[model samples]
Target chain A: MSTAPTTEKGRRTRARIVDAAAELFYERGVSATGLGDVIAASGTGKGQLYHFFTDKGDLVSAVIRHQVEGTLAPQRELGLHRLADLQEWARQAVLQHERSPVMRCPLGSLVVELSNRNADAASALEAGFAQWRELMSGWIAQLQRRGEARTDLPADDLADSILAAYQGGLVLARSRGDLRPLETALAMAIEGIGSRRAPAGRHRAHG
Target chain B: MSTAPTTEKGRRTRARIVDAAAELFYERGVSATGLGDVIAASGTGKGQLYHFFTDKGDLVSAVIRHQVEGTLAPQRELGLHRLADLQEWARQAVLQHERSPVMRCPLGSLVVELSNRNADAASALEAGFAQWRELMSGWIAQLQRRGEARTDLPADDLADSILAAYQGGLVLARSRGDLRPLETALAMAIEGIGSRRAPAGRHRAHG
Candidate 1:
C-alpha cells in the first residue's frame, strides 16, 4: 500500500519517483529493475522513497496508474467522439510511434511482462485496461447512436477490438522495424468500425 | 550460427535443447533464462550443447525456427483457403488459448522482449513473422481471387491486420484473465475481411 503525501512538496517528490520508476520499468522489465535503481534514477534519497511506497508492489501499482494517465492523455486531448476523430486518432498513434525510439505501447508493454508475475500488478493492469476500454466504449456508443459506427455489435466489443489492434500492431511494427504494420492494422480496424451501413427500413432523418 | 546435425541422435539432442530453451524463454524470459538452465532442463551435457550451438544466440535462433514451425503447424494442418477456414482457424486459436495456462502467442511473446535486445534474435523473429504473414496472405489471396474475401486492400495488409488482432487480443486476454477480448478482436477482423461487397457491375455467375 502507498501512503498519501499530504504536502504539495511531498506530492511532487512522490510523482517524481513514480515517473522515474515508470521509465525504468518500461525500458527494462519490472523484474530487472530494483528499488535502488529507481532511487538513483529519480535522484531521491532512500528515506523519501520509503515514505511513499511500502514495497516494490506498491511502487508498481503507482507506476501502472501513472502509465494509464500517460497513455490516455492524447486520446482525451484529441477526443474519440466521431468517426473522423477515430481516424485522426489512428493517424496520431502512428505519428507518435514514429517519433518514439521503440514501437511499444507504454501500458501494453508493462502488461506483457507483469500480468502473470504479480497479483496486484495484474489487477492494476486489468483496471487500467478497463478504464481505457470504457472511455473508448463510450465514444463508440456515442458514434453508434449517431449512426456513424457499427451498431450490430455492442460498443464495448468494438472498443476491445480496436484496442487489440493497436497493441498487436505495435508488436508487429516493432518486429518488422517498419510502421506499415501498425498503420495498416489501425486503418483496417477503423474502416471496419465505420463501415456500418444504415439499417434497411430505418433510414436516418438527416445526414 | 547453428550446426547441422549429421546423425539422428544429434538431431534429437539439438531439438530437445531448442524445445527446452523455448519453454524456458517463454515461461521466464529470454534475458533471464541462461545456458545452464537450458542445459539442465534438456538433460544434455554442456559439451553436447556447445557441439550443436555456438552460443546462446545460436540456440535462440534455433528456438525461433522451432517456434515458427510450432506456431504455423496449426494453420498448415487446418488450412486457410476459405472464409470458413479462416473463421475456424480463429476459433481454434481461441480454443488453444483456453487450454493453455497463459494467454500468449508463442512467437509473439518472444518478439516482445527480444525485438530490441538482440539483433540476431530480432532478425530471426522478423523472418518468422514474415513467414507466418506470407502463409496467411496466401490463404487470403486465394479467397480474394475466389471473390469470397475483401479485395480493396492488399492481401498482405489484411494478413498483418488479422495477425495484429491475434497478438493484441492475446495481450488483453492475459491482462484481463479472460478470453472474450481475443475472441472479439479476431471475430471483428474476419467479419471485416468477408464483408467485401461484389464489385459494382460484377456479379458472380454461380450460386
Candidate 2:
C-alpha cells in the first residue's frame, strides 16, 4: 500500500486530536465529550478527524493508551528508588494532587468511566494498572529488602495499598475540592510503613 | 395545587425508577445510562418518568440522594457506641467490597462523573461526603475519647485518611477487578491507628 504524502503531517494531526481528546475526556468525561468537541479542541476538520480515528470509541482507546504512556513515563523513570524515604515520596504524591485541584487522576477517571461498558477500554486500563503496579512493586520489594517496610506484608500488596491511598486521596480531594485529604491520606500511609504502634497519650482535640 | 389521588402509587413508582437508576448508574455509570434506559429498566412510561423526575438531571439528583442515604444509613445505625469496634467496622467495609465485586461505590462514581459539568450534582456529592465525613469524624472523636487512636493526627484528618483509603481502595479494586487492594489498604490504615511500631510479619503466599 502506497502511503499518502500527508501521512507524516496526518500522524502529527492525529496526535494532536488524541491529546485534545484526552484532556476533554479527563475534564468532561469520555461519554460526555462528542466528536464536535474533539474536532474543535484539536483545530481539525470533521473529515480529518474521522480520517485519523475511525470513531469516538477508537479515539477513546487511543486516548487511554496515550494517557497511560504519558502518566507512566515519569513514574517509571523516577523508579521508586526512594522507597526508603516513603514520607518524601508520599509528600511528592500529595503535591501532585495539590498541583491539580480539580482533575484528580486522569487514568483513574478513564477507568471508572469505561470499565463497565467497554471491554477494550477495561483491558487497556488493566494493562496500564498492571504496569504501574509492577513498577510500585519493584520499589516496595526494594524497601522490603532494606527492612523499611515489614517483611510479612507482601511487597506487591503494600504497593497496591499505597497506590490505593494515593488514588483514593485524589478522589476525595476532588470531591471536597480540597487537597487536604490527599495530604492526610498520603501522610498516614507513609506513617504506617514505619510504625505499627500508635504514639502514646496523644489525644485528638475535639473541634 | 391539588395532589393527585394516586400520589402514593405515583411516589412508589417514582421511587422504583430512582432505585433502578441508582443501580444502573452505579454499575454502568450515570453518563452511560440514559433516561430511556431508566424508564425501560423501571418499566415506567415516559409520562410517569417525566411526572416524577422532570429531566435527566432531576432524576440524577434524586438518585444521588438515594445513594447517599443508602451509604450513610448503615453507618448511622452503627452509632457512636460502635467506636470500640472501629477496626471491625473497617474490616467490614473491605468485606463489603469483596462481596460485591462488580459494584463500585456509587457516590464516589457520581463524584467522578459529575463533579465538573453539574453544579447541583457536585453540591449533592459534596454534601453527601461532608455528612459522611462528619459521621466518621464523630466516630474518630469517640475513639479518641476512649483513648483508641493516637491524638497527634486531628480527628478530621484521621477521618479523611480513613475515607481516602477506602475510596482509593475502591478505585484500585475496580481497576484490578479484585478486592485485595481494598483489604490491604484498610488493614494498613487500621493498623496505623494505635501504633507507630511495624506490624508483625504475616505474608500470605500467592499460589
Deviating ranges (above 4 Å) for candidate 2: A1-6, A83-85, A99-101, A195-207, B1-6, B79-84, B195-207
Error of 2 at B138 (Å): 1.7
Give a tens-digit lDDT track for model 1, residues B71-133: 987677776677998999999999998887678777887777664768888888999999999
Which residue pairs come into collision in candidate 1?
Answer: none
Residue B82 in model 2: shift from native, Å? 6.0
In angstroms, the error of model 2 at A123 is 1.1
> What lDDT does each candidate get?
0.86, 0.76
Full-model lDDT, candidate 2: 0.76
Best by TM-score: 1
Interface RMSD of 1: 4.5
DockQ each: 0.50, 0.40
- lDDT computed for candidate 1: 0.86
Q: Per-residue alpha-carbon lDDT of model 1 for A121-158, expressed as tens digits?
A: 88889999999999889999999988888777889999
- Model 2 agreement with the true structure over A94-185: per-residue lDDT tens digits: 66766664646888887777755577778788888888888878887887676566566777887777788888888787788887788788
